[model samples]
Target: MSEANECLFCKIIAGEIPSNTVYEDDSTIAFSDIHPKAKVHVLIVPKKHYANVAELAEQDSHELSHMVGIAKSIADKEFHGAYRLIFNTGEDAGQSVFHVHAHVLTGEVMAE
Candidate 1:
């Protein structure tokens, strides 16, 4: 596991910060978004701290696959056909938190 001093997701995983968790496992967690953009908005993040997808290249391949698999399950079980998976990487892309995460959204299309 990565060092915890500067990671928000790590804190969320350890229950240091409050969150609405939807799914959990040894390596990951899926939770509802506090500032939801849709009827079914969720965030899926790895247990380890990585700043973004690019930083996640060092992690094992299995974790990536499992994250995507979780995303699909969330979509199928929650969205039922109308949803989008978004990963904003930098300031220009709207990423506020400095951690790797997948945003699963549905119910309405977001504005451009």
Candidate 2:
């Protein structure tokens, strides 16, 4: 199978895999993480697959910005507009799914 075909996030975006969708738009989708790291943890993903943040930035910066916007929107609704955004670019960085995504974390005091 192709990379996108094998990608878990791609499957979720395709509706082949079920997800607890929190938000969605023409170019993006936001869903609750299966293993949430925070009280409010959502993964904001682009509908089109990209390997990592660098690839997404190079190919579609608009989507990257849109993902951040979505994250902020989720935080505003779920918490009190205080949020942390993370993009794990590679295995060493903790990116497990291969598809580019932004982790929106909030609702509790994060260890600094």
Give a tens-digit lDDT track for model 1, residues 11-68.
8988999999999999999999988888889999989878887777566667877888
Those runs of model 2 whose alpha carbons end farther than 4 Å from true positions after fitting are none
Residue lDDT tens for model 2, 21-64: 99998999999999999999999999998999999999999899
Scored against the true structure, residue 8 in model 2 reaches a CA lDDT of 92
Give Cα distance to truth, residue 36, candidate 1, Å: 0.4
How good is model 1 by TM-score? 0.85
Among the numbered candidates, top TM-score falls to 2
